[model samples]
Target: MSADRVVQLRWEPRHVADDGRVELSYPGISVVSSRQGEVVDRKWVPVGEEPTFADDEALIAVLHAAWRWTRPAA
Candidate 1:
């Protein structure tokens, strides 16, 4: 089996401009949409050494598996 790897994620709240535009995207990321109490949609944000994935669902699945695998015995 391949060696285990650690992942990290960093999130920073975006700043809104006086013209009602909020900057939700980072330098290499894209912000699809943002609304009050609805959702802050984004394309994808890079979290680690790997290149950013076009689809975040895959990343979410990997994280879910890691969480379950590393949990303490019940």
Candidate 2:
């Protein structure tokens, strides 16, 4: 069987605002993934409005799903 994969969002302590907005940092919001306890992918999230995602890439997909619970409907 293939190793179980996991996706995680990591950021610095003060880099994220109380409103869930991320400030400009060297490595903005980090989209990290690992399989079998080993890191396999890492990417920076593009700057955008809080609680909304425009990218459909695999990494960004996770963020989209998570934001659904936090943001109100338009």
Candidate 3:
């Protein structure tokens, strides 16, 4: 198992702008998604280390993840 603890939050696309892609992905060690009007989307398992900016090595990885996840223009 990976050293990083998976952090999952219920999916809320609105809430996902920041670290939301983590929630939108297919297998987040943790998953957070839309739960409105009594509807449930398929769940995902999220897994990743809590990124630390102070550490140069992990910082790059975190940044890349963030960059890849930006939402498209509506």
Shift in Å, residue 39, candidate 1: 37
lDDT per residue as tens, model 2, 2-73: 335566788733244555675533334676666667776766655444434454464466666544423435
Name the better of 1 and 3 by lDDT.
1
lDDT of each: 0.42, 0.55, 0.35
* lDDT value, candidate 1, whole model: 0.42
TM-score of each model, in listed order: 0.27, 0.41, 0.23
Query: Given candidate 2, what's the lDDT at residue 7?
Result: 63
Which portions of model 3 show Cα errors greater than 4 Å? 1-54, 71-74
Q: Write the per-residue lDDT of candidate 1 for residues 1-74, one digit (tens) a residue.
A: 11232223335444446657654433233333323333333443444445456446665664565444434355
In candidate 2 the C-alpha lDDT for residue 20 amounts to 68
Task: Encode model 3's per-residue lDDT on 3-56: one tens digit a residue.
Answer: 122223443222244464554323232232222233223333333455344444
Judged by TM-score, which candidate is best? 2
lDDT of 2 at 45: 59
Q: In terms of lDDT, which candidate is strongest?
A: 2
Model 2 pairs in collision? none
Structural RMSD, model 3: 16.1
